[model samples]
Target chain A: MEAASVLERRNFNGLLDALTARGYRPIGPVLEAGRIVYGPIQRDSDLPIGKTDIHDGGMYRIADRPDDALFGYNLPSDSWKQYLFPPHSRLWTATKSNGSFTVAAEEIDPPRYALLGVRACELAAIRVQDTVFTGAFPDRQYNAVRDDVLIVGVNCGQAGGTCFCTSMGTGPQLTDGYDLVLTELLDGDHRFLVRSGTATGADILRELPLTPATPADCAEAEALIEHVSGHMGRMLDTDGIKDLLYDNAEHERWDDVATRCLACANCTMVCPTCFCVTTEDRPTLDGATAERWRTWDSCFSLGFSHIHGGPIRTSVKARYRQWMTHKLATWIDQFGTSGCVGCGRCITWCPVGIDITHEVAAIRTEEAVHAHR
Target chain B: MRKPKLAVWKFASCDGCQLSLLDAEDELLAVAGAVEIANFPEASREVLPGPYQLSLVEGSITTPHDAERIQQVRSESEFLVTIGACATAGGIQALRNWADVAEFTRSVYATPEFIDTLDTSTAIADHVTVDFELRGCPINKGQLLEVVNAFLYGRRPDIPGYSVCIECKRRGTTCVMVADGTPCLGPVTQAGCGALCPAYHRGCYGCFGPAESANLPALISELRRLEVDDATLVRALRTYNAYAPEFRAASDELEVTG
Candidate 1:
């Protein structure tokens, strides 16, 4: 396995077969109900080929591309968070008999997964989750699933309308946290410029028929990154953004955003790095046995801050402020990394077009004027 | 240990919520084992007397007699729970809150003089205190079972007050409004149906009613931008959970603007 090899489009299915042989269930994007979602990929046709994505604040859809190009679209509506920290998973089970109780921790047997379309921002997000789940206090379940994951990253050919990965320095080009990386070159021969990030990644590539990549292929991949960076539809200035949000605690801008914010938690639900959850115990009807589960939760929910008397964040304004401030500012202190990866999911999936980049810029602009005047 | 007595009551609804309990075929036997089904007319003909430990009331207060009946039902039960859109937020029939009921009765009834009704249809909570409210067009049977089970075990039911988008994301369903041009009420609507309509490529008609602090104005404005006519917005809001304060106010404003 060389440093840079070309896997022609014809031999793509063999790549999937190689991953299967190594006990990795390949997962990739598939079009469902007019949008792309990650599901099991058994064949090459399962990929969203010849699909061109149209993304904007509060809007996302796919149309036909003039040429057949798999992995043409940006991030799917749902991220890879579902694979790692699943929505609902049992934690433990308890059985009661003769006034005595016996408890058994939920035994986990997660599948070894090979993620096919890991974008740069998504890879950054996975790393952010790594710190949250595997930091000082490790989540046994998440660690078990995360350990078996094989991330096959992809470099972007084009940017979505709401994308700001370049601004956040998380994407358009990946740095690390990938086993294998790919650049789908369009103008040249319909082929992929595949590179290995780890030894295991090289091992899988050995199973496929590969040719050494020419200098032209490497240059084309570089040019593709520059093109995506230049044509990005959105931008966010991260200059003192964390401090700016922290300083403007009572900014009237929050009230304005609240007028439009549904507090539906769409932003958090779609955000790749927003790791928040709640636990519940499901006791059976007869009181003989009980099962416990952990489910995804959001700070935008009123009950997410429930204390003794009532919920802490009651108004939509308070909840919205808490979310943005924590995402850009407080998350750094708590997790040692920014909670947002600039995936643009929070913007595009919002029912109302409430862009975070726009919100941050608005506050920054207001503060700049006040500071000087 | 004797099981607690459970009673089911109906008011101005179609009895769909009561049917949801019967639909829980698997949980129904377990429920019967845990609680003596003293007054579930839908499941049995044996009508037990009053002072029930738990009362599951369905439907809205549309008739004058039913309004008085709900008060009696409340007094006879230790803990009263409202089930379905009608009992919680005055179901689709709450459309009459805006129109002339007398004219409607005259148009539909053969003998209009014989019909007795109130000027406005309202939720059960308007008449008596509701310990809990289960939302849906017809409540989700799983959630209904959870509620019954929770009450039996002396704990609050684990019902979420979040939007349907959470459930949609969990179920791996793409956003219908974002992916397609369909105007959906999922953002303002509460989660309970497991995002049923969105999974099937249909916009949520708000069967579960308004979520906590539902920003109807925001959603309505977004729908308007999607080229949804004002008439459609009004009609969408006035559906299953029509008189839920947030939906009611939103529809009323749209009617004025339309």
Candidate 2:
């Protein structure tokens, strides 16, 4: 199939029709309970079109946008993890009768999904999770769903105040890891600069009505990506960051963050790439059968590291430290990438407004002073 | 010979910790083969009368009934293993220790007088002798498996007792506190979680509890110089394992001055 592109009103309904006709379960952003959240899109009308979200530490509110664009904001409270790694999933079942026991394995069947308007930073977060779930032992459940996903990456035209994707080296532009990349170009008529990175994506583009890339469209897309990249409100110096955090374990900065941090695990929960999980069991009404299930877990929870006698991270200070260190420093060793994609979700959803970028900069400055001494 | 019988018990908690055992999807079948699940009410409706070989208890003794029930559980089980921060420490509910119980009871429930509860929620160890205790707000399943396996094999479980710093080093995870000046509890926390928090670019809140021979005086001195106030330090220590001896002692020493 030859690669092609199609132009619609650049509104929600047009994108929905394009996604549905392709036999994909369209998932997009919608306003729910005064906040933007990712959920199933029945049609274009379901999306939060012409809507922008106001976000800061401990706050998120939706505001009306003048332009009726499908992808208008950085991110909402929900991340891609909600669909990929669900909050709870049954793993297996067990049954026993008359001293004889048998086990029943639960089958994992992920729906064929079309992720619409995925921001560049979120794409980076998805890649980080791909490495964690698929790179190592290969989580059978995660792989089952992730394999059939059709990702539609969108270039960020506007950066959120909390956004730091530029520093994470994973955003502002869709470089790779997508079926189709779209750059929204509003030139009198709303249009998109669509490019295909995979054969499947090319096939989809072939089916859609699209014009060959004009030099002006290409130039606009490039300029938009670069402009958005530079407009990032936050930055983190990854250079020697792992060593800086690891070597100064007793630094005084942790106490500062711990004071405000509720240790609510909301940051980890909302984080697109945080994949820590724990499990539970439920027995059938008959009491003859039992099923075990897996659920999302957070390091911030005192129970996450509970051992034989007590919790390892007994204090709020310890839990906070463990979370930051693992995300930035240890993540490099575990996944060969920083756990944080600098999506800014942690900062926005955090009830106390603890900004990760500010925390990293503080550490950097402290290290610099120590170096001089 | 019949396989050893295993039982799971819960007390005062969110039931999240006991759920960790059931979360071991890959090893669930293998685990079932090794033991007879005798009394896990959360997982099985069939309550096999115990003289259980092993009992995995979650949550803490927060009520009079729970305090008495723990003794019964200890009497019925050969091996009693407490799981999660609630079972090993007092858990978040232990925050009640710092406030007036009557006021708290009135705020949450309508008939505070009818609710029979203890002034302070305490770990199982305070009521009965525990064979072992798993640390964490929710204990890690991998370590849980090791402990169960060790009991089955009649040997001591090879669980690490050093600080989380060692696990971070062994896993080649950089120290967030050292490198980024992020405050971390890896230096004082017991290693079991494989240094999960540090790997995720966050400071340790000591969910795994205190390590053996933890130098709290030094940690406090550094924190103080770092401008950590006594109230903040006290609140930090009195989290999941607020009742655990080492943590409890440290937090007690940092009581708020009027």
Candidate 3:
């Protein structure tokens, strides 16, 4: 068993101060523009302590929670994707001089990040992205920033209306991929059960004024995590999901879902595993200078499938099928795991309320009927 | 080698898409260096002869003379690219396709005889074979530049074919539909505007026109399920790209069903 310690609710600000003192910029949840978004954090006040978000298909809003516990809600709209893979990045710039052009690469020096209030599902999502960006070719820009970031994960005591992480076996309690793990126990004592998962985490733990966690505290944390596991708002049936999707390439359910799917790419944008990008050249007005930039791209777009002949996935049905199948089926073949962490952002963010879980269920139901026949 | 002669032509449009080239403030001088702006009445009073290397035509065919003028423009240019919703999909004026155009002309114009316009507004592709069609109400300046760059480089332009959802996802924008129940047209609409409307906390109005293989029936039914009235659904499809085949078909089908 890993070593555990108790951090009182009042002393939470100390952890932020300690992280800042160590030169790691603390980034956590912030209530901005009526939504909980991730940005710079200095103290415990930055976290949406008493705020919880109400999320449903095509519906999301911030509401006051009954208690004042940090990380008392589900995933925020923006994930840590921005910190790892930014929206826009200039790759190289070329300046024309005397009929010749000289190209220079942009300097890449990422800041040391201490990600606070990270949920288990998000950690899993990060790992999924890690496999993508650090694969055979390796994205240098992503690695430059991702290699130094420290993960501070928070175990979910309760699941959100859109949360299906338990079903995906990626959440409620993080067993790996985090430097430090925290389980907030608001029962008798307003304290947190903190456990160091890495040497760096252990070093940070030594600096904090923490007490040795008793067995009762550990048991309390265990019970809460177990309870959250069984009480998820949504569940995905992953039994042979890869095979099921592969088998149902021509499934009518895809056509049904595609009709409702706006092909808006909202799900992919909110999705933590998606990694498609397209590069464009921006030349200066004087034609003297030019720069190339890589922006996030999606399979839902027609240009994503465009070739010299024409676009392969010209229809909404085809594009939506490509997105869902890639995330659930082909991802396993490519990365040894499902692209989805079951964070349920895609389902909640879909403009038309087209639920991925529901789509899978529809296909599974059809497959069962076919099997019976 | 001499620079390729480039020209910009306008019809019945707001000239917003043509202005997009002008809006390429930083890249204008660079692009100008690569191509000679022979005839651009919007930016310059100078008129160059036809037989141009590349021509960027904006607006829809709303008049008989403009229709004839397009044929001449097509004959003169080696490559013709239609820019924006007006050129690629008949534009917002194509809303007249659903109603009586004579009634519209009579109601608006003091002397209806002076107004010589076609009953239907049609995309440039409907009249002539366009080399490429760049979608958007006011085409994205970046994409417009990409098109020009591709032309100069003798390569295919890299424009997005996916829905607005993809762009929104790239930007990490919150889904307004899920977050606020805003009935966005992003899923069915072609992407290029960088999911602009969603970032501003409003649903997309399909300013970029319909995406490839847009499923109008499915989107319409889903919107209806969301309590969007039949009339509103029809109106939604009849927006910027009202004359676009996919939107036109959907709107027309709904008009009959309602």
Candidate 4:
């Protein structure tokens, strides 16, 4: 909500202090297990400063960059989903009292999280989950956690090998859905061109020591985003992909991919928008008390489609078809946008290096060839 | 209502799966209260005759004696659930099925005549029909609890048969195969271990066995395209769930094709 300002890298620590001052716990990317992952951070030293990453199909490594920029890396493997919609959540607990039963739901209030160095694609992913959680039913648990998150988005200066946000029309630059967007300017004096998108962000920015941005500073930030947008390593021609995938129900490529798929739900897991869940009930030894739980689930699982009869999607080919179709096709029909944000997390995370972009292109190419024939 | 009788039996295993039942710790107290833990040698010396409401069978039938024992256990129990890689598949020991047992017996034992084995370490499902099979190397604690809870509630257990990829997704773990070119079996392996290996930045070892309807030929071909050698491919299949039919056939095919 404040005019774009320039904050030197030295004074960046003040920003973290300001967020923490407001009772917000700051979480950002930190070097962990040879890769950058989201974790609680108090100091700038906790960030993967002066580090970048190399990511290809079935390959990832962290490398030293020329300058020390706090957010100088591609997206981390784990998304913000875990923080918002945790892997495991206790829903309610019940106990037998006399002849009646008493049930109590788990408290929904979660800590206010100030998420630092979020990328455009990841922001898009958060929005996707937002729509899902705040749907007709409006999941109270997800809403309670999501409402308290403060998004500090970082515009990507460079693309990773698996990145394709350009094709997905999602990123490389922050458009909206962020409290503040940051563009690191390593060209001259190391500084960030900060722009606030919300009133809370403006209040936070006013607290940090900041200088009004010069015309050159704004131009530099734009140039960096333009450079990133142009150099996306992977691309998906999603012009008619929804129809393309839905029509090719019996495509030979389905059988080909099914063989390599492994049905490991890794793609959906890394995806920013996949929101399937299953419930389990745990009882006390006396069977007098029980606690119902909710955890993340994947469509690739046979039990995910299980009914009284059997699983609806019985074959690997059928299961693969269901996931792809839902992500690219039916998701649009249901949610009005593509399930994928083009972050390329699925492509980079797949054990077999099965690229969704590659799979989609193969189908589109065959469709074109068939049309010509 | 009378408390349901719960029984646990073993054959050939590290007792890891049975240990998981005890490892329930906090939940074990509740489970013990809900059901009469009739016969669990790993946990208690107290033994009870069967006609059990639910029986949790661990390990595989390696000896001629165990082959007969599983049948008696099945007859006594109304619902038989096989837990872990050993009982669901053949487990790691099932690798013996590919080699000559006679040579292994002669080499390991001082007196080969004292040993009693059926040459193949087979699953409980091979001899008797199982109501359900919980697949994993040591088995996930949450899932094992679900199986017990489902049986007590008279409903089908909601264990997933999808690959470990789903677990990786839920945990938000990056894909080890795509990120590091690590040869992983997560794609085809079942989804009970919560994608454990991948979370630690390693490829899945197929501990939960091949997921339902796993496309073994296709996954193997992808590994081959990555220039994974024939022996490595064979070794991959012959690990935790080596004797699982899907992986066993794939490994045998690669051996023959070579």
Candidate 5:
């Protein structure tokens, strides 16, 4: 793959301008409401340049970085799922009148999106969603948006307090699933080491002002990625974790965590990979027409597992157990991978700061002690 | 044939349970076809006069007006089915029952004199004769269909009142409590969700409320032996269906020790 470099911090803006010129809407991370939110970005100024985020369970705050690094930010509160599988999207519409029912197919106009500054973990999360929404049944709506999306993955030069992508084997560096991968190098010169994983990214690189990467620059990028990985704030022992969680369902650690869990579902809501959703119908002013919409759902909601006459997981303890188990254990069965991306968003965003990594560790340690005894 | 008149009524809830009925996309059209939908205000603006064949009631009776309205709904409906935890068993809002109503009113409302709530949020069965009760925080659509289909076919609904453990066994899901030593409510929870939590590798949270013949004392003892604290046990029973007699009894039992 061809590689190049761009020194113009405004080169990102130029790329957006070029994309806009070529009739593609540029969507990327923009500073919104004290947090980095994914929205339409027209220029480099819209990017969270030199701005980093402090992410913990349920809490997200944006902080200013000392340097003018455009792609220096960590994962934002919003994931690419918002663009692919939106919170509220019309699936279809139905009308009933005159003793007959008429159904109209919803006009799904998937906007041509250029996702700028997607972190590697988020890219991995997108791939996980792809397997879900596109793999088996191939959700037409999700596929429509995803098929046209141009992914611009930014390698993490800085890790967030809540980031554990290294543990999940998904992030801190961009590997694939992106049109372009930009590594912001900080060696006296302000430049981005651009690498193309796809032909589209190569085409974009070809269009941008660039210089051939020296062997030293490539080494610098690799060293930077390694440094970021080493500095991961948290880690999870995923080896045999599925079996461990599957086997220790009676572990007292869960009960301890349950005491603190408010069951507010803030963790699942902020989770980049949590994909459970439910649909509802809203009637217009006229009683004849109704619109069906899909919304994000959480397992923590007692209503999520309600059956004929009652909820299956009526207790907060049970709901919390279901969520964690699905994320860690059963996710392996369903998706052939852990549902959790080790992003640590669940821990940071949890109202009571219930750390999944800590909980898992406690369970494992307790089990080990029991076995030794 | 004229569609059966369908009425959706709310008592006291977060509106999430009623939202579940509207959430049915794949079956909503078919449901509409099978019913007149005479008074579903959430999904329709037109409120036709009801002598409804099927009334899907959400929430619990938490006020004097609601207590009266439930009777009217029962009188006007052939089959009155309560949906969700609130209707079947007083919902999480039933947490208000633990504290003094006067204190609660004073805390929540600026003018307690204007408040018209009852001392406690009680299930629909407490006020009127309910034909059926769908369990859940938000009723499961699959079981909701089973209830509707049974009514349409003029047969008894085949909703299982057995423990969630049965469903787990049927689904070949390993017991998280047994295999993993995970504290679960599967042994006491009514089965209807087909053991989703267990299938997902988690313990059952007893969302289906209590199963018939639930051995609460034994389960509580076993949980304690497994190192579950009294506070944890109490919190578990005080969720969605906390006000239900069985769960309420179990929670009260736990509270006695503390």
Candidate 6:
């Protein structure tokens, strides 16, 4: 049953307490370095209440929102992927003795997490990663943390200057992929209109000091989502975009973008579903133990495409094309869904203002190549 | 198998890169066990001669005498690997490359006649072929160990050529340039120092030098958009690895001398 309840902002800490009481370490968006970052939060005060984010192409700043709303920020610099699919993880270790060695698996059982303030786009991103990690060949590390984690998704009450969740069809509303979803109602009463998406969510909500949400409360929540829907900071024309990317493999826009693209891997790293990783055997100088670790690798890295002799995608143009095409086009073929969740972290976090939306638009326009020349 | 003989040599540097080997304190024990220290004047007084399996050169070719010595050192070692910015990109001393050495000596030194130095401070690669080159101002000790370990095991040194942005993202450092409007060189600077400056809320000094896809002009334009002046940007590029081809070229292009 999708039971909706009204949770007072004053008693939000009780929700955190309920989760913690049930042995869940809550991870949420906290203010860090004048930016919103996903980190561990113990109580309500830990959340960036009264703060919202200002995000644009290559620009982001956290500013005081007019009112105090806990989940006021839209997209955080970090994705939920870092918690599930960690950037650096040891896969295995080998110890040597008398010219022969034995390898052992680095099996680990991580703690259960209650991911609070997860956005709809972030939830969608998690679902995409779930398929990537669990399908065909499963990643042991990802599945270990993914299985028992509880997600507390927050619907978009505010949209940043880089948001395009409306176009991506991933957000502004929480449809699925969350245990409990919260819609922070900041109008007159500082309260949250909470709903349970799953049985666990219902149980958790039952423990919280919640009052029954009226139809008006639900309607207001719906209206807020609708308002956010019309206020997307960015938009993309995804109509036949997959085919367009496939056909425009030789587009000169790639070269044009290359001139501005740092190939710094910020986009892929900030991306919720970019799962490319490279493993290195780190043997200590003593020749005793060697750890084989798989760290997050990006196609932007020249070494990412390295074979026996040298890297295949050596040029910035080739790397940029590979990332964009794979993300927009080939990813659908591989995972049956577009890789981008429209969080716009890639655009916001890039040092240069290289907007993927603009790139797609440029490719779609017939005169874009001619205009570039 | 006999432990490979390792030699550490210096030319023109602050010796911080040489100290990085000593700074690998716990790892130094492992390094000592793995290789025979044939020559390391900084760490030891006793020096063993020639035909070393590995030579870790730590400085730039700045003097006429050191220029010929590097060639002699190159011939004695099976594999010659440059250890820091000095060896890889001529370090901060390479700032002399743009300035007149005679004028510099006359201004800084009491006796200009005794100061016999090359006008230009060039990287080891400019003088002799380098088997491998490690970047960074002082070089990361962990990476230093990894390089040494790789050579011992006969494998390719897995040094990344990506920007500091990747490292910042990996380590969960907020993008200083994007988030705080701080003029950072992380996007153009190579990944090595674990995005150190950004973590501390300071812009990257470009100590590790230009990345594989620096795209300096684009980065500079963005920095300019952030209201960073050309003089400050040029100063950022002319730090530790000033003579690094990409940084040098970009700095020269953007140099706003009053």
Poorest 10 consecutive residues by lDDT, candidate 2 chain A: A1-10
Compared with the true structure, all predictions reach lDDT values of: 0.90, 0.78, 0.86, 0.86, 0.78, 0.90
lDDT of 4 by residue, A1-373 (tens): 4579999999999999999999999999998867788999999999998999987765677889988988889988788888988989999999999998999999877999999999999999898888888987799899999988999999998999999999988998889989999999999899999999999998998888899999999999988988998888899999988889878999999989876776767777777788888887877545688899998777877778888898898887898889989988999999888898999888877766788899999999998999999
lDDT of 2: 0.78
- Over A1-373, each residue of candidate 6 has an lDDT whose tens digit, in order, gives 4868999999998999999999999999998768889899998888898998888898888889888889888888999888999999999999998899999999898989999988899999999999999999998999999998999998999788999998999988999878999999987888999989888999998898899999999999999999999999999989998889998889988989999998888999999989999998888777688999999999999888989898999889999999999999999999999999999989998888799999999888954456588
Poorly placed runs, candidate 3 (over 4 Å): A91-106, A246-252, A280-292, A306-322
Which candidate, 1 or 4, has the higher lDDT?
1
- A212: Cα error in model 4, Å: 1.8
**Which lDDT value does model 3 have at A233?**
77
> What does fnat come to for each candidate?
0.74, 0.00, 0.75, 0.85, 0.00, 0.93
* Fnat value of model 1: 0.74
Cα error, candidate 1, residue B252 (Å): 1.2
Q: What would the per-residue lDDT of candidate 3 be over residues A1-373, giving only the tens digit for each residue?
A: 4789999999998888888888999898898767888889987888888888987777788899888988888888888998899878999999999989999998899899999888989999999999988988898899999999999999987888888997788987889878888999989988999998899888888888899999999999999998988888788999999999999999999878765776666777788888888787866544668899988777876677777897888777888888989999999999999999988888777766678899999999998999999
Candidate 3 vs candidate 6, TM-score winner: 6
Q: What are the TM-scores, per candidate, against the unseen true structure?
A: 0.98, 0.63, 0.92, 0.93, 0.64, 0.97
| Model 2, span B53-167: residue lDDT tens | 9999999888998988898999999999999999888888888877788888899998888999889988888889999988987788888887887787676665655567645
For each candidate, what is chain B's TM-score?
A: 0.98, 0.95, 0.97, 0.97, 0.95, 0.97
**A1-373: candidate 2 lDDT, tens digit per residue:** 2233535553435555666787889887776645567778897678777888766554556778888776777786678888888777889999978987688778876888999888888998988899988885898888888999999888888888778888888888888888888887765577887878888877767666666777777788788888888887777888888998898778888987776665556577778888987776554323467778886667865667878997788777788889899999999988899999988888875544678878878988987898899
Instruction: Give chain A TM for each model in order.
Output: 0.98, 0.94, 0.97, 0.98, 0.95, 0.97
Candidate 3 per-residue lDDT, tens place, B116-220, comes to 999889999999999999999899998998889888877778786768877776676676766666787887888889889989999899999888657677667
Candidate number with the higher TM-score (5 or 6): 6
Stronger candidate by TM-score (1 vs 3): 1
What DockQ does candidate 6 score?
A: 0.85
lDDT string for model 1 (B132-193, tens) is 99999989998999999899899989999999988998888888888897999998889999
Per-residue lDDT of model 5, residues A1-373, tens digit only: 5555654454656678767876778888777645566778888888887888766543456678898887777766556777777766788899987988788877888888988888888888888888898777889888889888888878989787778899999988877788888888877677788888887777777788777778888889889988998988778888898889889888887777766665546567667888887666554422467777776667865556767997898766777788888998999899888898877767765534578888888888999999899
What local lDDT score does residue A248 receive in model 2, on the 0 to 100 scale? 73
Q: Give the TM-score of candidate 1.
A: 0.98
What value does the lDDT take at residue A92 in candidate 2? 90
